[model samples]
Target chain A: GESVGLHLPTLSVQEGDNSIINCAYSNSASDYFIWYKQESGKGPQFIIDIRSNMDKRQGQRVTVLLNKTVKHLSLQIAATQPGDSAVYFCAENRDGATNKLIFGTGTLLAVQP
Target chain B: EAGVTQFPSHSVIEKGQTVTLRCDPISGHDNLYWYRRVMGKEIKFLLHFVKESKQDESGMPNNRFLAERTGGTYSTLKVQPAELEDSGVYFCASSQLTGSNTEAFFGQGTRLTVV
Candidate 1:
C-alpha cells in the first residue's frame, strides 16, 4: 500500500535553535499535505498545510516546503521553544479521497531548554 | 468556540466486555470523523460521517465495531466483545466542510484499555 513516511523517528534540539522535520510520500496522486502537533495526552493539533500546487507556505514561526518532483515535504520551525516538544506528524490527502487524511509515522521533537 | 469533545477520558475493561465511546463535534459542523492510534502506530481512520449519513466506513476494522450518528449532531462508537487489540486512543474530529481545504478540529480523545 502507498503510504507516507518520515525520515527521522526522533529529533533533539536546543531551545533557541531551529528544527526541521521531513516526510516522504509514495503516492504521487496526493494533492494536499498537513503538519500536526500532538502533545502528551492530547489529540493532534493542526499546525500548517500546503497544497501540491504551491511549493512553500508559511504560518507564524512554521514553514512547510513541498517538493513535488521528489514527493517530499519538510516543516521548519524557528527558535524552538519548550512547548515545541511533541510528536509531529505529516499527513497527505489522497487525490480522490475527500476528507480522508493519511498520516505518516511521526517524529518526536525534544526541545531542551 | 468549543472544539470537538469526547466522553470518558479513559476506560479499562476486561476482554469480551462491551464499551461505548461518545463524541460531540463542534456546533454546525456537518463532517465528523473517527480515528484510532494504537501504542506505536500512526493514527488510522475508522470512519467518516457527513451529517446523519455515513459517508465512508471503509476503514472500519471489523463487524465488532459499529458507529452511529443519529441526529447529525453527536456520534457514538460501540465495540462489542472487545479484544485486547481494541485498546487504543479513539479520537473524534469535525470539520465544517468535507474537503482537504478545510481544517478538522480534534477532541481530547478517549483512551480505551481492554484488560
Candidate 2:
C-alpha cells in the first residue's frame, strides 16, 4: 500500500478567500495524482488531476500543483464558497496496467461566510 | 448518462449474518471498482473488474468476501458472517476507459453497519 498523508486534518477559510490543501505521498512510482472532494454522505467527486510530468494544472475554480521532487501535492481553490466545504482527498495512481489508486487521509475544509 | 448506481444505500445486519451489495456501472463502462472506508479511516480499494473479468482483487480483505460481475454491466459483493470490522461505507465506481489519465465516477456508497 502507498502512504499518502495530509498536513492538516481540518482547515477553516473565509468565503471568497483562497484556500490551499496540501498532501504528501511516499510512493515514488506514482505518476498520476488526483484531488477529490467528498461531501457528507456522498461519494468522492473529482476536482483536478496532474501528471508527474506536469507541475501545475488549472480547472474552472481550482488549481492542482504537483511537486515530484518533494513528493507533495496541493489543491488551490480560488474564491472559496460555502459549497466548497467538504473533505478533500489526494490519490496517487501508480504507472501500470492496473492503475490502482491509493487515497490519502482527507482534509476537511470549512468555509466561514 | 447515469453514473454508477448502488443498491440499498444503507444496510444494518447482525454479526455472523450475510449481506450482499450490488452495483450497476454506467453504460459502456468497462472498468468497475469496489472501495470501502472504515470509520475514521482512509478509503481502501477492495477490487477491480474489467467487464466480466476480475482485473485485480488483491485488496480484498479475506475469503469471506466475494465479488462477481456476471454480465460485465453490474457487480455484486457478498460478505458472509459479517464482522464488526466490516462496518463501513462501501463505494462503487466505474470508468469508461482504462489507465490513469481517465476519470472514475463514483456512486453515493452503501453504508453497512454490523453489530
Candidate 3:
C-alpha cells in the first residue's frame, strides 16, 4: 500500500512570516507531487506542483521542494497572509496511472494576524 | 471556465438507504475523478472516468458503490445500503488530460452523513 503523510498536523505562523509544511511519502514510484490548500468547507485548491524529475518548483508566492532521496516534499509560503490560513495537503501520482492522485493527511496552517 | 460542480452539497440519510452524488466537470475537460474522505482520514480516490468510460476503479471501497459516465460529460456515484462508515465528504475533480503533470480542479464536495 502506498501512503503519503505530513510531518506536522498543525503549523502556526505570524503574518508576514514564511511558513514551511513538510510531507513524507512511501511510494518511490510516484512521479508527480502537488500541494493543495483547502479552506474551511471548500474543496482542496491547487497551489503548486512539481514533477519528480525536478527538485523544486516555484509559484506566485509559494515554492515546492522535492527530495527524492529522502522521499520528502515541502511547501513553502512567503509572507504568509490571513487568507493563507487553511489546511494544506500533498498529493502524489504515479506515471502510468490515469492521473489519480493519492492525498496525504493535511497540515493545518494557522496564520496569526 | 466553470469549475467542477456537485449537486446537493449536503445529504443526511439513514443506514441502509441509497444516495447518488453527481459531478459536472469543467467544460471540455476529458478526465473526471471521484474521491472520498472518511471521518478525519486523508482523501482517497474512488474511481476515474476518462470520458464516457471508466478508466480505473481500483479504489472503490465495495460493490455497494456504483459510478457512471454516460456521455463522457457529467458523472455520478451511487451508494446503496450506505453504512455509517460512508459518512464523509465526497469530492469530484476534473483535469484537462490524463497525465502525471495535469492539475486537477475540484468541486466544493458533497457531505454525506449516514446515520
TM-scores of all predicted structures? 0.94, 0.95, 0.94
DockQ of the candidate models in sequence: 0.41, 0.46, 0.52
Model 2 over residues B1-115: C-alpha lDDT tens digits?
7888999899999999999999999999999999998874788999999999999999999999999999898999999989999988999999888887888899989999999
Of 1 and 3, which scores higher on lDDT?
3
Error of 2 at A109 (Å): 0.6
User: Model 2: how far is B73 from its true place, Å?
Assistant: 1.3
Candidate with best DockQ = 3
TM-score of model 1 (CA atoms): 0.94
Against the reference, the lDDT scores of all candidates come to 0.89, 0.90, 0.91
Q: Label model 2 with its docking quality class.
A: acceptable
List, residue by residue over A4-54, the lDDT tens digit for candidate 1: 343448899999999999999889988889999998778899999998899
Model 1 has a DockQ score of 0.41
lDDT of 2 by residue, A1-113 (tens): 11134343899999999999999999998989999999987889999999998999999999999999999999999999999999999999884576678999889899999
Candidate 1's C-alpha runs over 4 A off are A1-8, A95-97
